[model samples]
Target: MTTAFTYSTTYLLDKSHYIETYEASVPADNSKKVYLIAILLALVGLAVLMLTEINAFVAWFIIALGGLEVFSIRFKKPWWLARQLISKAANTELTLTIDEHGISSKSIHVKSTLAWTDISKIEVTENGWLLYHNDSKNYLSSRALSDEAKAFLTTKTQLINALAI
Candidate 1:
Protein backbone atom coordinates (compact mmCIF):
# COMPACT_ATOMS: atom_id res chain seq x y z
CA MET A 1 0.00 0.00 0.00
CA THR A 2 1.14 3.54 -0.80
CA THR A 3 0.24 6.64 1.14
CA ALA A 4 0.12 10.02 -0.60
CA PHE A 5 0.82 13.45 0.77
CA THR A 6 -1.33 16.33 -0.39
CA TYR A 7 -1.38 19.91 0.82
CA SER A 8 -3.12 23.04 -0.31
CA THR A 9 -3.26 26.67 0.69
CA THR A 10 -5.20 29.69 -0.47
CA TYR A 11 -4.13 33.22 0.26
CA LEU A 12 -4.13 36.71 -1.12
CA LEU A 13 -0.79 37.78 -2.54
CA ASP A 14 0.33 40.94 -0.83
CA LYS A 15 2.31 43.73 -2.43
CA SER A 16 5.48 42.73 -0.63
CA HIS A 17 5.38 39.24 -2.14
CA TYR A 18 5.26 40.71 -5.60
CA ILE A 19 8.14 43.00 -4.77
CA GLU A 20 10.17 40.12 -3.41
CA THR A 21 9.48 38.03 -6.48
CA TYR A 22 10.45 40.88 -8.74
CA GLU A 23 13.66 41.44 -6.82
CA ALA A 24 14.57 37.77 -6.98
CA SER A 25 14.08 37.53 -10.73
CA VAL A 26 15.31 40.95 -11.81
CA PRO A 27 19.01 41.77 -11.61
CA ALA A 28 19.93 44.61 -9.26
CA ASP A 29 20.40 47.85 -11.14
CA ASN A 30 23.82 49.48 -10.95
CA SER A 31 22.95 53.20 -10.83
CA LYS A 32 26.40 54.12 -12.17
CA LYS A 33 26.12 51.83 -15.19
CA VAL A 34 23.87 54.27 -17.02
CA TYR A 35 26.31 57.13 -16.52
CA LEU A 36 29.28 54.95 -17.50
CA ILE A 37 27.66 53.77 -20.71
CA ALA A 38 26.47 57.23 -21.55
CA ILE A 39 29.96 58.65 -21.08
CA LEU A 40 31.50 55.90 -23.24
CA LEU A 41 28.95 56.30 -26.01
CA ALA A 42 29.46 60.06 -26.00
CA LEU A 43 33.24 59.59 -26.15
CA VAL A 44 32.92 57.05 -28.96
CA GLY A 45 30.55 59.28 -30.84
CA LEU A 46 32.93 62.21 -30.37
CA ALA A 47 35.88 60.12 -31.54
CA VAL A 48 34.06 58.90 -34.65
CA LEU A 49 32.94 62.45 -35.42
CA MET A 50 36.53 63.71 -35.08
CA LEU A 51 37.85 60.85 -37.27
CA THR A 52 35.31 60.55 -40.10
CA GLU A 53 33.66 63.97 -40.00
CA ILE A 54 30.32 62.19 -40.55
CA ASN A 55 27.87 64.94 -39.56
CA ALA A 56 28.90 66.72 -36.34
CA PHE A 57 25.19 67.00 -35.55
CA VAL A 58 24.91 63.18 -35.27
CA ALA A 59 27.64 63.03 -32.61
CA TRP A 60 25.96 65.70 -30.52
CA PHE A 61 22.66 63.86 -30.88
CA ILE A 62 24.24 60.73 -29.43
CA ILE A 63 25.57 62.74 -26.51
CA ALA A 64 22.17 64.30 -26.03
CA LEU A 65 20.61 60.78 -25.74
CA GLY A 66 22.34 60.41 -22.35
CA GLY A 67 19.69 62.57 -20.76
CA LEU A 68 17.04 59.95 -21.53
CA GLU A 69 18.94 57.34 -19.54
CA VAL A 70 19.32 59.68 -16.60
CA PHE A 71 15.62 60.44 -16.80
CA SER A 72 14.77 56.71 -16.71
CA ILE A 73 16.44 56.21 -13.32
CA ARG A 74 13.40 57.77 -11.71
CA PHE A 75 11.38 54.69 -12.61
CA LYS A 76 12.83 52.27 -10.15
CA LYS A 77 11.41 49.42 -8.05
CA PRO A 78 8.73 51.45 -6.34
CA TRP A 79 7.60 52.81 -9.66
CA TRP A 80 7.35 49.28 -11.04
CA LEU A 81 5.43 48.12 -7.97
CA ALA A 82 3.03 51.00 -8.35
CA ARG A 83 2.34 50.01 -11.92
CA GLN A 84 1.84 46.41 -10.88
CA LEU A 85 -0.61 47.53 -8.23
CA ILE A 86 -2.50 49.49 -10.82
CA SER A 87 -2.64 46.40 -13.02
CA LYS A 88 -3.22 42.69 -12.29
CA ALA A 89 -0.88 42.01 -9.38
CA ALA A 90 -2.71 43.81 -6.67
CA ASN A 91 -4.76 41.62 -4.32
CA THR A 92 -4.36 38.49 -6.39
CA GLU A 93 -6.05 35.50 -4.83
CA LEU A 94 -3.80 32.46 -5.13
CA THR A 95 -4.55 28.84 -4.49
CA LEU A 96 -1.62 26.44 -4.41
CA THR A 97 -2.01 22.68 -4.37
CA ILE A 98 0.85 20.27 -3.91
CA ASP A 99 0.82 16.52 -3.86
CA GLU A 100 3.03 13.50 -4.48
CA HIS A 101 2.59 14.07 -8.17
CA GLY A 102 3.47 17.75 -8.65
CA ILE A 103 2.44 21.34 -8.03
CA SER A 104 -0.64 23.21 -9.14
CA SER A 105 -1.34 26.88 -8.82
CA LYS A 106 -4.43 28.96 -9.54
CA SER A 107 -4.53 32.70 -9.32
CA ILE A 108 -6.90 35.43 -10.38
CA HIS A 109 -5.20 35.68 -13.76
CA VAL A 110 -3.73 32.26 -14.52
CA LYS A 111 -3.65 28.61 -13.68
CA SER A 112 -0.68 26.29 -14.15
CA THR A 113 0.47 22.83 -13.28
CA LEU A 114 3.98 21.45 -13.15
CA ALA A 115 4.81 17.82 -12.74
CA TRP A 116 7.85 16.74 -10.80
CA THR A 117 9.67 15.97 -14.03
CA ASP A 118 8.69 19.27 -15.58
CA ILE A 119 10.11 21.33 -12.77
CA SER A 120 13.65 22.02 -13.87
CA LYS A 121 14.92 23.50 -10.64
CA ILE A 122 13.96 24.87 -7.27
CA GLU A 123 15.69 27.81 -5.58
CA VAL A 124 15.20 28.66 -1.94
CA THR A 125 15.55 32.35 -1.30
CA GLU A 126 15.45 34.21 1.99
CA ASN A 127 11.78 35.12 1.60
CA GLY A 128 10.48 32.30 -0.56
CA TRP A 129 10.95 29.53 -3.08
CA LEU A 130 11.24 30.09 -6.80
CA LEU A 131 9.99 27.16 -8.84
CA TYR A 132 11.57 27.38 -12.26
CA HIS A 133 10.26 25.60 -15.32
CA ASN A 134 11.02 26.37 -18.95
CA ASP A 135 10.44 30.05 -19.54
CA SER A 136 8.40 30.97 -16.52
CA LYS A 137 8.53 30.55 -12.76
CA ASN A 138 6.27 30.64 -9.71
CA TYR A 139 7.08 32.21 -6.38
CA LEU A 140 5.92 30.80 -3.06
CA SER A 141 6.53 32.73 0.08
CA SER A 142 8.08 30.78 2.98
CA ARG A 143 5.03 31.50 5.06
CA ALA A 144 2.77 29.92 2.46
CA LEU A 145 4.32 26.48 2.85
CA SER A 146 4.01 24.20 5.80
CA ASP A 147 6.96 22.21 7.17
CA GLU A 148 5.61 19.03 5.66
CA ALA A 149 5.22 20.70 2.29
CA LYS A 150 8.77 21.95 2.55
CA ALA A 151 9.99 18.43 3.28
CA PHE A 152 8.05 17.09 0.34
CA LEU A 153 9.57 19.73 -1.93
CA THR A 154 13.03 18.83 -0.63
CA THR A 155 12.48 15.21 -1.56
CA LYS A 156 10.73 15.70 -4.87
CA THR A 157 12.21 18.83 -6.44
CA GLN A 158 15.85 18.56 -5.34
CA LEU A 159 15.38 21.66 -3.21
CA ILE A 160 18.38 21.50 -0.91
CA ASN A 161 18.60 24.30 1.56
CA ALA A 162 20.19 23.26 4.81
CA LEU A 163 19.36 26.52 6.48
CA ALA A 164 15.87 26.91 5.14
CA ILE A 165 14.56 23.40 5.59
Candidate 2:
Protein backbone atom coordinates (compact mmCIF):
# COMPACT_ATOMS: atom_id res chain seq x y z
CA MET A 1 0.00 0.00 0.00
CA THR A 2 1.09 3.57 -0.61
CA THR A 3 2.40 5.18 2.55
CA ALA A 4 3.69 8.71 3.01
CA PHE A 5 6.69 8.96 5.30
CA THR A 6 8.97 11.68 6.59
CA TYR A 7 12.73 11.69 6.78
CA SER A 8 14.16 11.05 10.25
CA THR A 9 17.54 10.50 11.86
CA THR A 10 17.42 6.75 11.41
CA TYR A 11 16.39 7.25 7.81
CA LEU A 12 19.31 9.61 7.36
CA LEU A 13 21.77 7.15 8.93
CA ASP A 14 20.59 4.21 6.89
CA LYS A 15 20.53 6.36 3.80
CA SER A 16 24.04 7.58 4.45
CA HIS A 17 25.40 4.10 5.00
CA TYR A 18 23.59 2.67 2.03
CA ILE A 19 24.83 5.49 -0.15
CA GLU A 20 28.38 5.07 1.10
CA THR A 21 28.33 1.35 0.43
CA TYR A 22 26.89 1.78 -3.03
CA GLU A 23 29.34 4.55 -3.87
CA ALA A 24 32.30 2.54 -2.63
CA SER A 25 31.24 -0.57 -4.54
CA VAL A 26 30.79 0.79 -8.07
CA PRO A 27 32.68 3.49 -9.88
CA ALA A 28 30.50 6.15 -11.46
CA ASP A 29 29.96 5.74 -15.20
CA ASN A 30 30.72 9.43 -15.74
CA SER A 31 34.24 8.76 -14.51
CA LYS A 32 34.68 6.19 -17.27
CA LYS A 33 33.53 8.69 -19.87
CA VAL A 34 35.91 11.32 -18.53
CA TYR A 35 38.76 8.81 -18.61
CA LEU A 36 38.03 8.05 -22.24
CA ILE A 37 38.16 11.76 -23.06
CA ALA A 38 41.42 12.13 -21.19
CA ILE A 39 42.92 9.22 -23.15
CA LEU A 40 41.88 10.87 -26.42
CA LEU A 41 43.44 14.16 -25.35
CA ALA A 42 46.63 12.34 -24.42
CA LEU A 43 46.73 10.72 -27.84
CA VAL A 44 46.30 14.13 -29.49
CA GLY A 45 49.07 15.53 -27.32
CA LEU A 46 51.34 12.64 -28.35
CA ALA A 47 50.66 13.38 -32.00
CA VAL A 48 51.44 17.04 -31.44
CA LEU A 49 54.64 16.05 -29.71
CA MET A 50 55.59 13.91 -32.72
CA LEU A 51 54.85 16.66 -35.30
CA THR A 52 56.27 19.69 -33.54
CA GLU A 53 59.55 20.09 -31.83
CA ILE A 54 57.62 20.62 -28.58
CA ASN A 55 59.82 21.41 -25.57
CA ALA A 56 60.56 18.23 -23.59
CA PHE A 57 59.19 19.81 -20.42
CA VAL A 58 55.90 20.76 -22.06
CA ALA A 59 55.46 17.30 -23.51
CA TRP A 60 55.96 15.67 -20.12
CA PHE A 61 53.53 18.14 -18.51
CA ILE A 62 50.83 17.30 -21.04
CA ILE A 63 51.28 13.58 -20.46
CA ALA A 64 51.21 13.98 -16.71
CA LEU A 65 48.01 16.09 -16.81
CA GLY A 66 46.31 13.48 -18.97
CA GLY A 67 47.40 10.70 -16.62
CA LEU A 68 45.98 12.55 -13.63
CA GLU A 69 42.63 13.00 -15.34
CA VAL A 70 42.51 9.33 -16.22
CA PHE A 71 43.32 8.28 -12.68
CA SER A 72 40.73 10.55 -11.10
CA ILE A 73 38.08 9.42 -13.53
CA ARG A 74 38.78 5.76 -12.92
CA PHE A 75 38.23 6.16 -9.20
CA LYS A 76 34.78 7.45 -8.26
CA LYS A 77 32.70 7.18 -5.11
CA PRO A 78 29.86 4.62 -4.99
CA TRP A 79 26.34 5.66 -3.83
CA TRP A 80 24.58 2.35 -3.26
CA LEU A 81 23.58 3.22 0.28
CA ALA A 82 22.24 6.63 -0.62
CA ARG A 83 20.46 5.10 -3.54
CA GLN A 84 18.78 2.56 -1.23
CA LEU A 85 17.66 5.31 1.11
CA ILE A 86 16.24 7.45 -1.66
CA SER A 87 14.65 4.41 -3.22
CA LYS A 88 12.81 3.60 -0.03
CA ALA A 89 11.63 7.18 0.40
CA ALA A 90 10.52 7.42 -3.20
CA ASN A 91 8.81 4.07 -3.11
CA THR A 92 5.30 3.73 -1.72
CA GLU A 93 5.76 0.22 -0.40
CA LEU A 94 4.99 0.04 3.30
CA THR A 95 6.05 -3.47 4.22
CA LEU A 96 9.34 -5.28 3.69
CA THR A 97 8.75 -8.88 2.74
CA ILE A 98 10.96 -11.61 4.14
CA ASP A 99 10.22 -15.07 2.88
CA GLU A 100 11.71 -18.09 1.10
CA HIS A 101 12.51 -15.80 -1.83
CA GLY A 102 14.42 -13.55 0.54
CA ILE A 103 13.85 -9.83 1.21
CA SER A 104 11.56 -8.15 -1.28
CA SER A 105 9.62 -4.87 -1.33
CA LYS A 106 5.91 -5.06 -0.72
CA SER A 107 5.27 -3.05 -3.88
CA ILE A 108 6.54 -5.93 -5.96
CA HIS A 109 4.41 -8.78 -4.65
CA VAL A 110 1.60 -9.00 -2.13
CA LYS A 111 2.24 -12.70 -1.66
CA SER A 112 5.60 -11.89 -0.11
CA THR A 113 5.53 -12.67 3.60
CA LEU A 114 7.25 -10.65 6.31
CA ALA A 115 7.77 -12.08 9.76
CA TRP A 116 8.69 -9.98 12.82
CA THR A 117 10.75 -12.86 14.18
CA ASP A 118 13.39 -12.10 11.58
CA ILE A 119 14.66 -9.05 13.42
CA SER A 120 17.10 -9.35 16.34
CA LYS A 121 15.74 -6.37 18.24
CA ILE A 122 13.22 -3.53 17.80
CA GLU A 123 13.54 -0.30 19.70
CA VAL A 124 12.13 3.17 19.50
CA THR A 125 14.65 5.91 19.12
CA GLU A 126 14.13 9.65 19.53
CA ASN A 127 12.54 9.97 16.11
CA GLY A 128 11.75 6.48 14.89
CA TRP A 129 12.10 2.74 15.35
CA LEU A 130 15.32 0.88 14.81
CA LEU A 131 14.97 -2.52 13.18
CA TYR A 132 18.20 -4.44 13.61
CA HIS A 133 18.36 -7.45 11.40
CA ASN A 134 19.88 -10.61 12.91
CA ASP A 135 22.86 -10.93 10.57
CA SER A 136 23.65 -7.41 9.37
CA LYS A 137 25.15 -4.58 11.34
CA ASN A 138 23.04 -2.13 9.40
CA TYR A 139 19.60 -1.10 10.65
CA LEU A 140 16.32 -0.16 8.98
CA SER A 141 14.79 3.23 9.80
CA SER A 142 11.05 3.57 10.26
CA ARG A 143 11.35 7.36 10.50
CA ALA A 144 10.52 7.83 6.86
CA LEU A 145 7.12 6.28 7.39
CA SER A 146 4.00 8.43 7.49
CA ASP A 147 2.06 9.02 10.68
CA GLU A 148 -0.41 6.29 9.75
CA ALA A 149 2.41 3.92 8.97
CA LYS A 150 4.10 4.89 12.22
CA ALA A 151 0.93 4.09 14.11
CA PHE A 152 0.72 0.74 12.42
CA LEU A 153 4.35 0.03 13.20
CA THR A 154 3.81 1.16 16.81
CA THR A 155 0.96 -1.28 17.14
CA LYS A 156 3.10 -4.00 15.72
CA THR A 157 5.82 -3.10 18.17
CA GLN A 158 3.35 -3.20 21.01
CA LEU A 159 2.11 -6.56 19.89
CA ILE A 160 5.68 -7.79 19.82
CA ASN A 161 6.28 -6.42 23.33
CA ALA A 162 3.11 -7.99 24.60
CA LEU A 163 4.16 -11.31 23.21
CA ALA A 164 7.51 -10.96 24.93
CA ILE A 165 5.79 -10.19 28.21
Candidate 2 per-residue lDDT over residues 42-67, each given as its tens digit: 88678767878978677767777788
Estimate TM-scores for all models. 0.71, 0.35
lDDT string for model 1 (1-165, tens) is 978999999877778777887887666777776577667777777886788768888877876766555555656677778787787747988899999778888997879787876667788777777777778777767678899988787676464333234
Q: Model-by-model lDDT, in order?
A: 0.75, 0.52
Identify the runs in model 2 with alpha carbons over 4 angstroms from their true place. 1-33, 78-165
Q: Which structure among the candidates has the greatest TM-score?
A: 1
Q: Report the number of the highest-lDDT candidate.
A: 1
